[model samples]
Target: MNNQDFPERTCLICKDKKDKKDLFRLVKTGEDKYAFDEKQKEQSRGYYICKSHECLKRLSKHKKIKVDTDDLIKMLNLLKKGEKDYLNILRAMKNSQTLSFGMNMVLEEIEHTHFLVLAEDISEKNERKLLLRAKELNITYVYCGNKQQLGEIFGKDEVSVIGVKNKQIARGLIN
Candidate 1:
């Protein structure tokens, strides 16, 4: 299927239509209970919201949702758990041996890499080189966390860049 084949949903706060996969979903599980559906597969009444802080803030103040402040905050926290989710994905890729790290290793294996994850604190020279190579190869890249944070995922003291080898995992990370 192509991009146009994906279903669209409207954000409750902004009332703007967007691809379902591009929005965050919140499902009503009970009369007054709501849960964040990170995977967007919950079997309940689901509400779509734009994946932006502005929409989140607007939703929190929405009077029609009937949710108390505390419950709304808890549900919002669940949506903000993306950092943990990203780390878990990295760990899974590491265990599956589908990840390459370090500047030299990633550059050497660039041909096989599906995606690039660079540290926010990466040196200017290294970032320029990796970005240039990625652009030439048409490989998608993203910046996340700092060197120390990314390095911890690979049991190293520091890592400025990581290359994901699995196409499906890379697509998922980008989305």
Candidate 2:
């Protein structure tokens, strides 16, 4: 038998035949344990699903089980807090007179920046420039959310980058 004679697996969701290697293998490890075989080395009874998220959703719905993405969920929750904390920091900065926005203002005060937040939708050129400034000034920085979300926090049409002058909030945002 040659590779042409090798058995193909069917996607549980789409009901399409594909080479076993081309599909995601989910193996039943124990009586109730089922995991996607990312490494493709598990020795157990297995089923295949397509790589698309829709396929995963269908499988999850059919099986009545939620796919585990704990790390992603935790990160998303942190991003949510990061957004609210950013708004609070901005408000507090108004009282302390230490907040700055806009590219030039942030670039000018880069040295005083305790933490920097860059919008993911910002232009590559702007991202490169701001990141370089952050690195040169040794300011702690992170990329979170998108331009629209950042804009809502700062009350603008859109915001590319925001620099935090408050050290405490900056620390919280980073961690």
Candidate 3:
């Protein structure tokens, strides 16, 4: 049998088809609707967490994301395979003055950029507005999957609130 003959699995994040590897598959029953199917819980509109902060960072920096087929393949190698700790991130949220993931990605070592990247789903207008403002203020900022990653860096989860190095909310989301 050829690769085409084999049952194909689609990723919800990038919306591409590939035989299951280490991808976190999801099933989307309807438009903008999806479910995490760890057990292959019936292909509906499965999404995979293959798009990690790295890829998100690149797109954010470029200020655009093209809906391309290969882009989907690129996403597959970027994200993590499972849910991260929201709580530990929460704790870090409280302790650390701030956290940012993309554009100014949090590498093992960070040199500068006194800004915070709020990772969450927002409109293009919002993204542009925030980017402009961050530039105006000379502050670092980026958006990601959710604000939770900010919390994770802070050692907790479900963080509705995120702070920057100066102990204040980032202008992007706060505004």
Candidate 4:
């Protein structure tokens, strides 16, 4: 019933704790060696990983990993390069794009807390995730048709994507 009720161990990756019985421990015993320790008998520097592949990727790249007690975390393993690149792309995407809402919504649509721009008849090739994210946000979405027209209304060079960020994000969006 309680987290502390179990015999727990902390995950070296997320620094969260789980019952030690559930975590899978990986130990680094030598320069290029790794092993899974079921009994945790090995004294070598070890880490615990959760079952998800994404979390496993996070574990492999996390900086505090120690192959030996004194060894500085020199670099992540080579297989994580592509995953690291993917994270970099996500960082850039967040900075480059954002959602906007109709100014009229401030007066006319108090009933609707959020919105999704449907881009009524715009090209779907590039703005796909923007649409999906709108649905995921469960906002009031509209398909105004014609990216060019939408861009004109928003005074942007191109427009097929937009979202009405919640109050928490509104301040950040404004500044």
C-alpha TM-scores of all predictions: 0.56, 0.52, 0.32, 0.28
Q: Write the per-residue lDDT of candidate 1 for residues 68-174, one digit (tens) a residue.
A: 56645765575457655777789777878789999999999999999998886899999999999999999988666679878998899999999998898899999
- Supply candidate 4's per-residue lDDT for 80: 39
lDDT for model 4 comes to 0.48
Clashing pairs in 2: none
Q: Tell me the lDDT of candidate 1.
A: 0.80
Better of 1 and 4 by lDDT: 1
Give the lDDT ranking, best first: 1, 2, 4, 3
Write down the lDDT of every candidate, Cα atoms only. Answer: 0.80, 0.68, 0.46, 0.48
- Residue 90 accuracy (lDDT) in model 3: 33
Instruction: Look at candidate 4 and give me any clashing residue pairs.
Output: 99-163, 115-140, 116-140, 116-141, 118-142, 120-145, 121-145
- Model 3 lDDT on a 0 to 1 scale: 0.46
- Candidate 3's C-alpha runs over 4 A off are 1-78, 81-91, 95-113, 147-163, 166-175
Candidate number of the best TM-score: 1
Q: What is the TM-score (0 to 1) of candidate 3? A: 0.32
lDDT of 4 by residue, 23-42 (tens): 56778766454555656788
- lDDT per residue for candidate 2 within 150-175, as digits (tens), equals 67665777888788887876787665
Q: Mind giving the per-residue lDDT tens digits that candidate 3 earns over 1-175?
A: 7854665665444556655653555555454444445466674644554435543344334322233344444443334322243223334455454654433243321334355455565446546655665576666543444655544554556443232554343343333
Top candidate, metric lDDT: 1
Superposed on all Cα atoms, model 4 deviates from the true structure by an RMSD in Å of 15.0
| Every model: Cα RMSD to truth | 6.9, 12.6, 13.3, 15.0
- lDDT, candidate 2, equals 0.68
Q: Where does candidate 2 have its weakest 10-residue lDDT segment?
A: 70-79
